[model samples]
Target: MICIDSISFSFECSHTVLEQISCQIEPGHCLAILGNNGVGKSTLLKCIARIYRPQQGRITINGAELNSLSNRQLAQLLAYVPQHSNAPHMMVFDAVLLGRRPYIQWDSTSRDRQIVSALLEQFQLTSYSARYLNALSGGERQKVFLARAMAQQPQFLLLDEPTNNLDPRNQHEILRYLQELARQQQIGIAVVLHDLNLAIRYCDRFVLMKDAAIYRQGGPEIITPQTIKDVYGISAEIIEHQGARLIVPQMDHITKAADDAKTTANHH
Candidate 1:
């Protein structure tokens, strides 16, 4: 299990983004971090991945403090895919191959190439293996970045708004893939997401961050109607059917109905 104990973070000139936030990410589970904008969802992921240092508290992986591990050692244990991809002017195959750098020594090995090839195929990017990343669409580039993260073969994967560039079809496809990946590989996966329906459908764990702290954290029950109103400032209904929970956002007032009522009152 990965434990984040009372971690807080801030910038020198900005306000504190995270305040004593703590959570556990266990292997063989996928968690979705939910929050409105500027609530520090992305910053929390950065702190876990060691991209930004927290001012207070500690982060540990299986009881080993992250501070004790070197950069290479940390990379060996976790892989992070940011919200954006800044792939260099290189072929897709080569870009994905870079994830194996921590394991590669002296020169590229056949095993390295084999792993890269297998990922490309799994993502349906085999046809674009020779194409440059710059030539692909935004969604394609995002998928390539995800493939690279998988190539790392780490114990955990951290993703920030991974579905941003994907279409609706692709969004579900990618999330389903990650769901299976976590179940099959026993890897802990944390994704920062705003899509409540998708989160309920795909993830086994939920952590709802609010005002720089965790407002709620648990399973599907945490995403109740009142919880939605409290966290998102909106009314929503949760319905279960066919072995899945769906969040149906409630319409506050229907303008057409209001207008009809007004017309009826005027006639009366």
Candidate 2:
């Protein structure tokens, strides 16, 4: 389990990015860090990943303090995928094999090779194993990055806008896979997502942020239309369809109603 306790951060002495933030990433569950852009959603993830250290408070993995762990030890416990990744001129297989670096003593063993190969198959990148990462499309490259993180066998995973490059179909597929991965492996996952529907559907918990502080954090029940309007500064409506709840922005709903009225008037 990863515990974030009353952490605060700032790039400069002034202009705090996050203030008094606290949350928990529990094993076997996926936590979605959600808010409007520039509200410190990404900054919070960076703090947890240790890419940016919080100036105050503490974070711990199980019983070990985050700052106490060495780089190699931390890598063995947590894996993070950023919002944007550069596609380097490296083979797909080699890129993923790099995730095993924390464990390799002098040379990689057959076990490391097996883990990389299995991840390639799991992520459906086995055929692209020989291809260069720079040669693949954006969506494909994103998958390779995710597979690399999974290869680390970390107890916790952190991802930022992981579906940014994927089409609608791939978006759902990847999120669903992550949900399952967390449950099956008992790995705690914290993902930053913009789509509320996707977050409500796949994530086990939600942390809604406003102005760098969490406005609310709980299960799917907390994602009401009122909360959406409060966080996003737009009116929305939550409706159920096919045994699932969906969020529709108020403007879209109004436009659709107007269109229907126009069609009826034309028929009359």
Candidate 3:
């Protein structure tokens, strides 16, 4: 389990990015964080991943403070996949095997090789294992990065925009794979995503953020038209398709009229 309590962070002489944010993510669940650009979605994930320290809050993993864990110990518990991954012109298998660095002292062990090979096969990268990272396509590289994260065998996984550059098919494939991991391995996954429809389809729960603070959180049932208009400043229509909720943006005319009325009232 991961617990975030009143976490806040700010850059030097800059405005606060996160403000008193708190959330608990249980094991075997997938939580999706949704927000507009520059709303600190990535920052919150970084804090949980321990890349950035919170200025005024506590982050605990399984009742232990995050700061108390050593680097290898922390790596054993959590694996993080950032938004952008640039490989060092190395073989795909080599890059994925690096996830086992915490376990290997100096060189790759037999167990490490077994895990990496299994992950490569699982992600359909075994054929490309010998290929360099720079040679693969964008979607292929994304899969390699995800494979690296999975090779860590961490209980908790944090991903930042896992499907940022993929087409619809690859995006669905990647997210479906993640869902399977959470359900089968009982791994806790916290992902930052921009597509509300995708979040509604794949995520077990949703965390909505606005202006650097949590606006609301719940399942798809709680993500209504009012919530979208309030949190995203846009109107939308929600529909159910085969048990999954789909959010469709309403035409801008209605929203524009509402904004115009408000503007006229303010001038008056």
Candidate 4:
């Protein structure tokens, strides 16, 4: 289990990004971090990944203090897939194989090659394994980066908008794979998501952040229509279909606001 206890972070400009945020994530469960833009979702993810340090808090991994762990030890326990990815002029296969660096002992091994190959095939990137990452599309490159993270075989996976560049089908496919990885391998996955319905469908746990703090955290039931209004400042209708919770934003409400603005403009 990873326990975040009263963590707070601020930039050098004195703008606080995270404020006393606390949450717990365990193996075999996928936690979705949901919030509006600039609500410290990415910052919190970076904090958990140790890329950003908090001023006042302690993070524990499996009952041990995170700060006590060395760099290599931390890498073995945690892997991060960023929202935007940049790759060098190298083959995709070789790029993914880099994830195995934590386990490699100064030389590449057959197991590393096998793991990279399997991930490429799993993500349907086998044909592009020999292609340079710069030559691939944004979505394709995102898939390769995810493949690399999985290749790391870490205990915890931290993703920032993992579905950013994926098509609808691929989004579902990747989420399903991530859930499977959590259950089958007992890996802890914490992902930042913008789509409420996708979080409902795939995530078993939820953390709603607002104003740099955790506003709510629980199962899907915590995601109420009012919650949407509070978090997104938009009216949404959550309906049920075939035993699934679906969130549908009330576009008419937005349109009404727009019409009101237009009326005020005409009057002026």
Worst 10 residues of 1 by lDDT: 249-258
Residue 256 Cα positional deviation in candidate 1, in Å, after optimal superposition: 12
lDDT of 3 by residue, 1-268 (tens): 9999999999889999999999977788899998889999999999999999999999999999999999999998999999877768899999999999878898899999999999998888999999999999988998899899888899999999999988999899889988888899999999999898888888897899999999998776778889888888888999878987788888785778789999999999
Q: Write the per-residue lDDT of candidate 1 for residues 100-138, one digit (tens) a residue.
A: 988988888999999999999999999999999999999
What lDDT would each prediction earn against the true structure? 0.91, 0.93, 0.90, 0.92
Ranking by lDDT: 2, 4, 1, 3
Would you give me the overall lDDT of model 4? 0.92
Winning model by TM-score: 4
Where does model 4 exceed 4 Å of error?
Answer: 260-268
Q: Compared with the true structure, what per-residue lDDT tens digits does model 2 show for residues 40-143?
A: 98899888889999999999999899999999999999999999888888999999999999999999999999999999998889999999999999999999
TM-score for predicted model 1 compared with the true structure: 0.93
Estimate candidate 2's RMSD in Å: 5.4
Report the CA-based lDDT of candidate 3 relative to the real structure: 0.90
Candidate 2: segments with Cα more than 4 A from true spot: 252-268
Clashing pairs in 4: none
lDDT of 3 at 95: 96
Clashing pairs in 1: none
